[model samples]
Target: MPTEETQTRTGEAPRRPRIRLDQPLTPRRKLIPDYDPEAFGRMSERIARFLGTGRFIVWMTVIIIAWVAWNVAAPDALRFDTYPFIFLTLMLSLQASYAAPLILLAQNRQDDRDRVNLEQDRKQNERSIADTEYLSREVAALRIGLGEVATRDWIRSELQDLLKELEEQQRSVAKGEVFPGDGDRGRDVDDR
Candidate 1:
């Protein structure tokens, strides 16, 4: 029940004035009936699409020609919108006024859809680029790791060196090249 003055008392924090739903300060307006805005927008788009077609143009032309011919040719008693065709012009003007707004509404909706689509495409492109960069980095790391690992040619060369040393030792033993522990020094010096 605080009034506006009470809500703004000095030396204290200002408080928001409370609204009473049961007793509105201003006269209440009648509630408007609810309707679907999307449906209305779709209907406007349909009308705008129809208005842009060649068939609509042909039909409008035929109607206007027939109206003029009838009004000019018919008997005076039967004719309406005679000579000046002011009524026909007024009708066309009214049609144009409604059509312009509907066409604008349809264009606005299309622009919104295009904007959303472009944003999604941009996000997709970014994800694709990130994935490509990650894969490239992984490939580079694998190449560097493989460079430090052993290769088939190095193992073959090491095996060949060990085989040559073993063959030299076998030849020396077959020729009776004895050491001091073998006790063949007397036979060795007599042969020499």
Candidate 2:
């Protein structure tokens, strides 16, 4: 136990000493409990937001409309991409190249955001734990101080005084001391 000296200021009660906050993190302090992803309820929300983007909708629509128009309107000579559809195949390959990377980029951004949020949560938990530990230490110190000042000596004195008074009363009763009375007095019938 580390002990320190303290004194009262004017008429105020004496202060209990305490350790400084600049000290390193200790196991006694804890903020948030263990984190569980299922308990956080955030995975579904992120997926929904990604699926609803305008860019995804636009790209899908353009691909479908272009395929239909090319089949219906192009004559044999006008069809630059014929039965084998070499040009159409190249166009699809180009789109896939860009689309696949864009999807990956979006996923990477989401992962970064999740990492940042998790770090924030962890710091908040640490602060909470430190605060809880500080409060517990202060409360324990107060209890110790109270115990020292509110001693049992006064209670013991009071009990002793009561016992002396009871002994005096018992002596008086044993002496058969009584005041004179009209022993022959009788009650009248129907007296209110």
lDDT of 1 by residue, 82-124 (tens): 9999999999999999999999999999999999999999999
Best by lDDT: 1
| Candidate 2, poorest ten consecutive residues by summed lDDT | 178-187
How far residue 77's Cα lies from its native spot in candidate 1, in Å, is 2.1
Write the residue-wise lDDT of candidate 2 on 1-192 in tens digits: 322233332445555666678987567855867776543335544544554689768977897567757765887666555556567778878877865655565566678899999999999999999999999999999998988774688788888888886665555445533112311232222231
Please give the TM-score that candidate 1 achieves against the real structure.
Answer: 0.70
The TM-score that candidate 2 achieves is: 0.46
Q: Which pairs of residues collide in model 1? A: none
Residue 72 lDDT in model 1? 98
- Report the C-alpha displacement of residue 115, candidate 1, in angstroms: 0.5
